[model samples]
Target: MTNDDLQFAHDRPIAMQQHDLLDRAGFAQRLALAISSWKNQESLVISLTGSWGSGKSSIKNMALEQLAAIQGSQVIEFNPWQWAGQDKLSSAFFEEISRVVQRKNPTEADKQLAKVLRRYEHRLNAGAAVLSGTAKWAPILLGSALVTTALGSVAEGTAAQVTIWTVSAVSWLGSLAPWLKQAAEWCTKRSKNLDQEAKDSELTLSQIRAELQKLLSARQKPLLIVLDDLDRLSAEQLKAMFQLVKAHMDFANVVFLLLFQRDTVEQGLQRAGFDGADYLEKIIQVPFSVPAISSGQLEAVLSGKLDAILANEQQLQQRFDKAYWDQMFQRGMRPFFGNLRHVYRYASTLAFHCRLLRGTEVAEVNAVDLFALECLRVFAPETYADMPRHKALLTNNEPFARQDEPQRARINQVINHLVFLAPSTHKPATRQLLQEMFPTLDWVFKNTEYDRQTQLRWLINSRVCCDDVFDRYFELSVPEQDVPNSLLHELARRIVDSGPFTTLLASHEEDRQAEILQRLFGLVDEFPLELSLAVVQTLLQAGDVVGRRMSFTNWSPRQQVVRLLRLFLLRHDDEAARSQLVIEAFAVGPGLVVVEQLLASEYALRRKADFGCLDDAGLEQLKSAYLCNLRELAERDPEAFLANPDFESYLYDLNRYGEGGDEGRRWSERHITSTTRFLQFAQTLVNTRSRYSGDGVTHIDEISLHSLDELLGKECCADWVARLDTGELSADASQILGLVKEALAHPARSETAEWND
Candidate 1:
C-alpha cells in the first residue's frame, strides 16, 4: 500500500457512528421501554429534552429503530420546523401518520384508498346528473374522501394527481367518514324537532370521541412518530405541537416522541404555554439524559483507535500505549469538555496529522497524542478554520463583546473557568487568550488590526479576561474581583500545564517577557509601589529560563539591592515578595562592568533613551540613571575634571552618550587641541637635522621619527609629545624640512601645514 493509503487508515475517526457512538445503552433501553409502555395504550406523548448534542435525537432514533425491528411497529420522523404556521395542524399530523402507516402496509392502505377514489372520480365524470341524485351522500363522501386521500398523496407528482385526489378523498372518509355520516343522520333527526341550522351546529363531544375510538381500535400496530430537531424549531412551533397533542389525546394508538436539545427544549417548553418542568412531566414519559464521556472512557476510546492504527506500523506502535493516552488527555484535551463535537473534531485532526508524517506514520494515536494534537489544533488555526476567527473577532463589542446581558454573563462564566489557564509568569496578550477561549468571536474580527478604535470597541464588548482591564490600562483589581481573579489564575495554570495557549506562550516568551518585565520594572524598579506582589512574586520566582533572561534591575534606576530592600521593609516582611526580588537581583547582579562603562568609560556609551531609542519605559529608566550619574560627577569634580588632561575626553564621552549624536564632533574637537599640543612637543623632543631622537636615557633614530611622522596623524604625534616630553628645537631645524616632506606625502591637515613652508 502507498504511504497515503496507510495514512488514511489511521486518519479514520476513533468512532464512526455519531447516532450510536455515545455510550447511551442504558438510556436507549429506558427509551425503548417507554415506547413499549405506550405501544399498547390508546395514545402517548413523550418529550425528549437534553442539552444541544446531548444525544436526545440519537436516543430517540435508536428507540424507534429498535421498536420497528422488534415489535413490527411503524416509525415516522417529523420536523416541526418544516411545518410551522400551517392553519390546520391535523393535516400535518396525518402527513406524519401517513408516512409511518404507509411503511407498515403500503398496499393495504393504497388499494383501499384507491378504490374509494375511483368511485369519486366516476361521480365527477358523470357531472351534474350524478351529482344531483348523489348530493345527499356526495357532500359527506367528498369531504371524508378529501381529508383521507390527501395523506401520502402530497408526495406524488401531478401525473398521479387524479389518483392522489381520489385516494385523499377516500382516506379522509376512512378516518372521519363514519363520524360525518352519523353526524348528518343525527342532525337530520334532530332538525325535525328543531331549526335546521341550529341542529347542524350541535355536534356532541361523545360523537367525536366515539369516532376517534373506532379509527384507533381498527389499527393493529401502534404508530411511532419521532419528532426530531424540535430543538431547532422556534418556540411557537413547539407550543403548537403541544397544543395538538393535548387537544387530541385519544386520536389513535400513537406514540409521539419529541426530541430536542435539553436547555433549548426546556426553554421552548416554558414558552410553549406550560411551566418548563410541569409541561415536561405531562408529555415526557421517561427523560433519558446522556452524560458526558468520562475521562477514563475518553482515554480508552483514543487508545483503542490508536491501537488499531498501530497494528500496521509496529515501529511506532510503542508510542500508542495507555499511559501515553492519559497524558495527552490530561494535558491536551481535558480542558475542552463542553461537547463531543469538539472531541470528535480533535480526533480527526490528530489522525490527519499522523497521516501527514510519512515516516512516523502512527496510524493510531494514544489519548495523549490525541489530546496533544487537540491542543495544537486549537492553538493553530490553519489546521482548523474555527480558531483563527475566534482569535480575530473575540476582542470587540461585535459578537464576542460582553454586551448582550445573557452572553456577557456566559462569557464571564467562561472567563471564570479560564482562571487556571492564564499565563501569570509570561502573560499573553488579551487578544491571544480571548481567541482560545472564544473562537467564535475571533472569527469575527479578522482584519481590525490597523484600526485601534475598532479593536478597542471589541475589547470593550468582549471584556474577555483581563483584556477589558488591559485595554483600558486598568490595573488588576485589588483584593481580586472573585470572578476575574479565579479566571486569570486558572488560565495561568492551564496555559503552563497544557493547551495550545501554553505552546504559543512558550514560543513567544522571549519577546513577550522582555516587554512585560520592561513595563513592570519601569513602574517599580526605582520607586517603591504596591501592586500584585503575589502575582509578581510568582512569575519572578518561577526561575524559568525565559524569566531569567530579563534583568528586572535594569528596568528601573534604584540599586537592584536597594529596591528589593525597600519593598521588603515597606511591605512588612513579605517573604514571597522579598524572595522574588532577591532572586531576580542575584540573577542580574550589580552590573560592575556595565557600571564602569557608565562611569570611567573610554569610548562613549550612548544611552538609548537620549535619542528616543528606548521604545519601552524599562530601557528609559536605565537612560535616566546613567544621566543622573553624569550629573553627579559634573557637580563633584568639575575643576579637577576640567584641568585634568582627560577632562576633554570625559566631556566627549558625555556628548556621545546617546546613539550617533555629537560623538564625532566631540572626538574632532578634543583631537584638535591634543594634536596641536603633540606637534609642538615633538619639536622639543628631537633636533630637526638629527636622525635620532630620545628621552635622556633612550635615543630614537631620526629616520624612524621621520617615518613615524609620515605614518601617524598630527593627533597621534601630539599624544606622543605628552608621553616623551623633551625640550628645545634641534640645531638642524632645516632637516625638519625633510621629515615634513615625508609627512606632506600623505594628506595634510590644513593649507598652513605645507611641505616647504
Candidate 2:
C-alpha cells in the first residue's frame, strides 16, 4: 500500500528483555529472588494478580525465567481453561502433576510414589464413573415379583451389579434346588471376600496421600506449577480449579504460581456460590499484586512501537518532529494508553491504516494530525464517530455559517458527553485532544476560538480539521473527481507551463473541469502572491475552455475567476500596483473571455459604486490595451473572431473602446459578407425563456430593429439585407433571417434569463 513498508506490532507478552519496552524486568527479578530464597517445605499457592492486559502473564514468565537459573526449581504450566466442561478435572490435574514428576529423571523411590499416586487417582476416577454410568432397560425378578427400576442407589453403595445379576439369574432357576443352594453359597462366599478386601483397603486414600507427602519432601528440587489465564474460565470451571488447589494443600515441596485478574476471578468465584474473598484467602499462601505500570512506561511502550513503524515510513518521518510528537503525547495521546496491550493494539491498528492509504494519499495528510485522530479512533471510538458529521461547524471559517448557535450547542453537548465513554482520569485530556484538533470547539469550554489563519493552515496542510480533506481520512481514499491539495499545489507550481496544465484541465469531464477551476480560484484568493499571480494567469488562459461549456450564469467558472481577481485586487491597498498587475496580465493576451470579464466588472463598479481596485487613468490604459488587442485579433483572423460565441459582446466592447461611429460595423463587414458569417452574428443576439403558461412552452426573444441599429449601423444592415440572395441561402440561414426580421417590427423586450446550469 505504501513505499515505506509499515509493520504491525503483536499483542503477545514480551518473553525476553529485548522485547520488554516497558522496563518490567526489574520487578520480575525481585519476585523471582523473593520466592527462590523462601524455603517452604509444604505446598504453597502464590498468586500474581493484575487487571486484564496489565502484563501479569509477562511478569510471570520473566520471574520463571529467573527462577530457572536457580539450583533446585522446576516449572510446570497448567492450563485449566482447556479442560472446562469435563467430568473429572481434579483427577486429571493430579495425573498431570504425577506424570510430570515421574517423567523428569525420577529415582526408584520417586517412581514407586508416583505409581501409588496414579493408582489412587484411577481408583477415585473409577468410583466416580460407576456413579455416573448409564444402564440399559432391564428387569429383575426379586422373590417372585418382577420390578423395573433404576439401580443408581445401589451403584453408589457397595451393592455390586455382578452380584445382583447373579442373584436374578439364580432365582429363575429356583426349581432346581441344588443349583439354588450352590448360587446362594457362592454369593455368601463372594460377599465375605469383598468385606475382607474392603477392610484391608480402607487406608488406600490416606496411604497415597502420605506417600506423596513423603516423596515430595524427599525431592531435591521444588516443583513450581504455573497456571495462567485462570480468569478466562467460567464460574463452574473456576470453582473446580480452586477446589483442586485447595485439595492439594498438603503436598510438601510443591508450589503453584497462579496468574489472573483478581477481580475477574473473584467475580467468577462469587457467581459459583462461594465467598470469593474468603475462598481465595484460604488457598493463596503468598499474594503479590503486579505493580501498577507508570504512565511514562506506557507512553514509552507506545512511542517505541510508533517510532519503529515510523522509521520504516520516510514521508512521515520527514515531517515528524520528536518535540511535537512528545508534546502531543503528553497533552492528549498519553492518557489513551493505560497498558502495554493498548500500545500494541494502537500500533498494529496504525500500521494497518498507514499501509492501506496509498503513498500519495498518505503524503496528502499531516502525520501528527493522523496520529492524534487515530488515537481517538482506537481508544475512543464513539467520540471519533461523531466527528465527521459536524465537518462544517468544525472546519468552516465563514462568519455567517459559523453563527448557528443551536448546532454549536448540540456539538458542545456531544463533546461534553464524551466524558461518559472515557475514564474519569483521562476525560480532561480527551477533551483537550478534541480542542487541539478543532480550535473552534474550544468556544464550548474556553470562551474563545481560533482565527482564520489557524483554520487556513489546517486546510493547506491537509489536516483532518480541514473540511475538504477530512472525509478522505475516514474513507481512507481520495475521491475520484475531487482534487487533493497535494496535486493542486503541484499544479499551481507548474502553472507557468500552461501547455500541460491546460491539456490536463481539458481532459476531464466538464463538471470536473469546472471543479478544478473552482479550486484554482480559491488558491488565487488565498495563496501567496508569487503563486497566486501564476495561478490567475493560468486560469485566464484555461477559462476559454471552461467558459465554452458554461451557460454564462451563476456557476460560470469564468465568473469565478473574475471574483478571484476582485478579491486579489482588493487585498492590495495601492491602486497603482493592483491596476499595473492586471494590465500586465491583459498585455500577455489572456483570451477574450477573461478580458471582457474584467472590463465588464469595472463598468459595473462605475454604475453601482459597489466595488474598488482600479482608478480612471488605469481603466483608460486597460481600455487602450483591449482595443489594440481586439484590433490585432480581428486583423489576424477575421472569420475566427466573427465565429467566436461572444461575438456581440466583443464588438460592443470594441465600439465602446473604439473612436465610435460604425467602426465595429465596418470591421464586421470584412467577415460578415456571407450568409454563414451573418448567421453566426445572429446567434449572439438571441435569448430563450420559459413562457408563463403551465404547458412549459419556451419563447425565443430577439433584439429589436432599434437595438440592432444602435449596435450595427441601420444602413449597414439594410444594405446587407438587400444584397442577400434568398435562393442561394441555406434553409438554416433563411430561417435565422426570418426570426431576426420577425421581431424587428414588434420589438420584443428581452429579459436577462437565468442559465439552466
Candidate 3:
C-alpha cells in the first residue's frame, strides 16, 4: 500500500452494504420493504430519526442500496443545505424533481407531472404574495429602530460611539429582516381592483394539484425522495421543506425518507409558531428511529481501527501495553463517545497525528498518552485547549517556597476544577483519566499519591506528563533547542572524547545546554548495562565545561555530571567493576576532580550503606589515584594545572585523606614561585572573616601560624614571605605579606585551623 493511504482516514460514511460495521443494514432492509409495499395511495413520509452523527447518512445509503433491488423504482435526492440562503429552497426542490424526472427515462405521465410540478410551484409563490402586505409594519418598525439609534447617538455620543450604535442597530434589524420581508410581499388572492388574474392564482394552484395527482397516479412505481441532513438546515429552510411535503406533494405512489434529528427539526418548527412534534405527526405516516448501536460494537470497531492507525510499528507498540490500554482507552477513552461518528472522528484524528509522530527521533511522544489526550481533545475540547496554557501547573512536581504555597494551591484548585468542570455525565470518568495522566494530583483527589521517584520514571519513559516533554504532544513535533530522545540516543551511541562532547553542548544557548545536561542525568540510568570508559571519559571531559549556569533549585550542570558518574558507576552488576571503572577513568582521564568527588560521596553513603557502592579499601585506591592524577597534571602543565577550578577543592580532599601534608608544601614551593601564585594557593587555607564596625566591613584575614606550621611549616611560609619584593608588590600581595608577618611573630596555637573551602 502507498504511504499516503496508510497515513490518515477520511471519515467518510459507509456507503455500501458490505461496509456496515454496526449491522445497521437491518434497519435499511425494513425501510426498503416499506417503500416497496406501496400500500397507501396518498404519499408516505417516513422519518429515519436520530441524533446528529449517529450514522444516519450511512444507514440511508444502505437503505437506498436495498431499494435498488426493486425493478422500475425511481429515486431523487434533495440537499437543501446547498441552497440554504435566498428564497430558492422551494423552487430548487421542484427543479430537482423535474430534473430527475426528465433525466430518468421520462414516460408521458412523468413528463406531464414534471411540467405540473413547475406550474404548481409558481402558483404557490403567487398565493404566498397576497399575505406579504400584512407584515409590512415590520420594516417600518426596523426603520424606526435605526432612526432612534442614530438620533440617540448624535445627542449623547462621540464619533466612535455613534458608529458602534449604528452597527448594533443594523445587526438587530437584520434578524427581523427576513420576517419583515414576508410582510412586504403581497399578492391579491381575493382582490377587487386587480382583476380576476390575481384571484385566479389561488384557483390555478388547485387545478395544478389535481393534474399532478392524476399524472402521479399512473406511475408504475413510487418515486422515492430521500432528504438527508435536514437538521443541518436553518429554521426557515426547514419550514419551507415541511410546507412542500404537507401542502404541495401529497400525491399517489411518491415516498419521502427524511433523515433528521427529531428534536432539532421540532426546534426549527417551533421557531415558526408551529408545534414541531404535532406538525411532524400530521406529515409522517411511518416513523423509524435509527437503531441504537451497542457499546460493544463501538469498542470493537474503534479497536480494530486504532490497530490500523497505529499499524505494526514496533517503536509505537513498545510504548503501549495491555494494562495501559485498559486504563487509558478501555476505561478512559471509551466513555466519551456516544455514537458512531464520535468513534470515526477520533479514529481519523488519531491516524493523522499518529502519522506525524511516526518516525520521530527515539520515540518522542508516548503513543498511549497521545490516545488519552486525543480523547480529551475530541470530547472535552475546552479542557484540551487549556492544556498548553496550564502546562506548568499540570506537570509541576517540585515543591514551591512556603511563601508561594497559597498561590500554588490556588493554581492546583484551578487544575482540580478541570476534573470537576467536565460535562456532567463525563465528570467522574474524566477525573479517572486525568489521574492516569497527571498522577501528581492524586493527593487532591484522594487517590494514591506519587513521589518524585515516580515522576523520574515518567521522565525516562518520555510520558506526556513529563514537564521536559509535555509540549511535544501538543506541538506534534520536537521543537527547536529541544533535546529529542533520538538525538540523545545517537549521542550516547557515538560518544567520543571530551572535546566533541563539550563542543556539542556548547553549541546550544546556555539554558538549552543546561537542558541537554539535565536530560543526560536521566540518560545515565538508561545507559546500557555495560559501562564503557569512553562514556565515562566523555562525561568527565564534557562536565569540565558544564560550569555555573543552572536553576538554583537544580544542581549546577558540572555537579550534575558528578551525579551522572555516580549513577554510571552504579550500573555495573559487579562491585569490583564499579570501583575499577572509576580508577581506570581517573588513570586516563584529564582531571582527578570528578573521581575525588564521586568516591567521596560514595564514601559518605557507605556509613549508612544505603547508596554506597565501595568498601574502605576500594575507596582508598580511588583517593590515592586522585592525588596521583593531580600531581601528574601539575608536572605536565603547571600553569593549566594551577588554573583548574577544582584544584583547591581536590587538594583539601587529598589532605583530609591523610596523604597531602608534605606533598602539598613541596608542590606549591616548586610550582608557586611568584607572589601571585602563592596567594592563589594560600587563599583557601587562611580564614577571612568580615566584621561590620565604624570602619566599613573590614576583612580580618586570620593567618593561623599553627595551620601553616602543620601543613606547609611556619618557617617555610616565613622564608617565602621575607623574600617578597616589597616595592613591586600589588595591593593583595602587600596584604598577604602583612598577615603572614603578624602570624609568624606570635606564639603559634596548638590546634591548626583547617582549609575552609
Best candidate, lDDT: 3
TM-score for candidate 3, residues paired by index: 0.77
Best by TM-score: 2
Candidate 2 or 1, higher lDDT: 2
TM-score, every prediction: 0.38, 0.80, 0.77
Global local distance difference test of model 2: 0.68
In candidate 2 the C-alpha lDDT for residue 172 amounts to 62
What ranking of all candidate models by lDDT puts the best one first? Answer: 3, 2, 1
Count of residue pairs whose backbone atoms collide, per candidate: 54, 0, 3
Please say which candidate is ahead in lDDT: 2 or 3: 3
Clashes of 2: 0
Q: What are the lDDT scores of the predictions, listed in order?
A: 0.43, 0.68, 0.70
Ranking by TM-score: 2, 3, 1
Which residue pairs collide, candidate 3? 129-187, 130-187, 132-183
Q: Which ten residues in a row have the lowest lDDT in candidate 2?
A: 134-143
